[model samples]
Target: MLFVDFTPPAPCVGDLNNDGVINTADLAQFLGQFGQTVAPGTGADLTGDGVVNTADLALFLGRFGQSC
Candidate 1:
């Protein structure tokens, strides 16, 4: 038998609160978790690489003010 390690992607990038929109709340959440490693589905890790750093922040900035 064959097995695959599949991890689902975040529903939306920068939508930390998962309120179906990327707004200030998400921004706050991201900032709070900045420079840390968080699991997928959590808006903190925008890159989905398990780390919340400048790169993720940058990606999130690109999606800022946009709704999912």
Candidate 2:
């Protein structure tokens, strides 16, 4: 028997609000958690460092205005 790979598409890094787009609303969502230690695997923690910092901010900016 052969098994096929079943990898799921990764979530959009900058779509913090998970609204199918990366925009001001996601920006707002990110800002709301800025400087805080976000929960593990949370969108606000873009860098996945467990904290929402400038790194995540920069990443968010880079992907802003993108559609999921």
lDDT against true structure, model 1: 0.82
Kindly list the per-residue Cα lDDT of model 2 for residues 11-52, writing each as its tens digit: 899897778899999888888999998676596998888999
Off by over 4 Å in 2: 1-7
Candidate 1 lDDT at 17 equals 80
10 residues in a row with least lDDT, candidate 1 = 37-46
True-structure RMSD, every candidate = 6.9, 3.0
Error of 2 at 46 (Å): 0.4
Report the number of the highest-lDDT candidate: 2
Candidate 1: tens digits of C-alpha lDDT, residues 1-68: 99996988557878778788888998898899988777864658877788889988898899999986
Q: Rate the local accuracy (lDDT) of all candidates.
A: 0.82, 0.87
Q: Which candidate is the best by TM-score?
A: 2
Q: lDDT score, residue 21, model 2?
A: 95
Worst 10 residues of 2 by lDDT: 38-47
